[model samples]
Target: MTDLWADYVDASPEQAEALPARGPFGDSPALADELLALVLAGGKRATSGPPDPDEPVTVGGHWVVSDGSDRERVILRTTEVRAGRLDSVDDRFAADEGEGDLSRGYWLQEHRTFVRRVLGLSATTDVDDVEMIFERFRVVWPPEHADALD
Candidate 1:
């Protein structure tokens, strides 16, 4: 099948050269699109993912952020990647997510729901202080060019 994000991304050789291999962002296409919009709007600078203690988190890696359908959206260059307890996700980081009122309370509620629903866990799962992989990234593709994706 044709790549779903082909229309939404610039796939020129130069862009590809800098992109490396990029992984999608969210559990669903809608959620990926939602978060990608925030990133493009300059409202989101940070994100969190399920923790993998055995795997190394690579900083300075280029990732293709995608929507739910697995379509590439924007290219992200990881600036920092660290593991932290979910409970330590403070107000500042939550606010940087730029989602839903930009409050820690909202972040917790929404993220908890996302973890349980998307990650396929019990509704009664305790995530209060669970381990998580937190990452800070910068847009590397479109931001470097003046032209729009369309």
Candidate 2:
């Protein structure tokens, strides 16, 4: 399992090379700031409901993809950045046999609300930068996802 936090990330080469250009959304710097705000506000967790008042707010990072089964493979991991560390509870959200996927619902709900309210997750940004942001800004529970670390 990966450590609770990491100084370096083991990212897919494809993800390591990703970089997205600005789009119709607006300025890249502003978008980055907003993302930073969200990251700092609550990290990058996908929640089933509103977060706890006592829960510490942090930044989270991950790579999401629809697997061949069409299930969302939400890779939740920790990050180390100048700002601090971060990770999402969604990474900690667990599932039972034949149960619905929380990560799928979590991201879908988060994106819907984000698009309708908070804007978008990114504006044509590269994957590796996202990775770096994650590596630099993520916070997580190390014991839950014990298999993802180096």
Candidate 3:
């Protein structure tokens, strides 16, 4: 299978670039594709990381987001980064995630499962006050192409 970014880099060494990326939910490719689609559609603008004091992706960093097959789909530029307890996530950020009715209740309910079921965190661990990294980013690739006119 073709690695999209590698092929691009090979074709255009001067223009092509690479950045860090990972599947949306660790190694789950299917969910990664779905989440990437949400971003592409302007439905998802932010993402949260698991409880970790050390931030992984930093502000002003770029990411090459990929799909289920690990094919590069979009480029994302981090615009903001914040860290806080998961329970402190407000409605605005939850809604911006574009998932499950766009409600805080939904975010909490779904994230609980995501943190446990998907991420494989300790099921016995208390979720409240867990350190969470929130990142806001902007899509930088697949520019809205439009026909040029004279």
Clashes of each: 4, 19, 0
Off by over 4 Å in 3: 1-19, 22-27, 51-55, 118-125, 145-150
lDDT of 1: 0.70
| TM-score of decoy 1 | 0.75
Give the poorly placed runs of model 1, Cα more than 4 Å off. 1-21, 52-56, 144-150
lDDT of 2 by residue, 1-150 (tens): 332123123333433442211111112445434433343344433222222234322344343322233332223332432221122322333121011253545543433343333334454422212211112222222233224334
User: Which pairs of residues have clashing backbones in candidate 1?
Assistant: 22-64, 28-68, 29-67, 29-68
Local error of candidate 1 at residue 60 (angstroms): 0.8
- lDDT by residue (tens digit), candidate 1, 1-150: 444234224554444444345455567667777887788788888888677545445786666666667766676666788787777788988998789999999999988877777667899998776677878777756544222432
Task: State the lDDT at 134 in candidate 1.
Answer: 79
Q: Which stretches of candidate 2 lie above 4 Å from their native place?
A: 1-6, 9-27, 47-138, 141-150
Q: Distance from true position, residue 83, model 1, in Å?
A: 0.8
Which should have the higher TM-score, number 1 or number 2?
Answer: 1
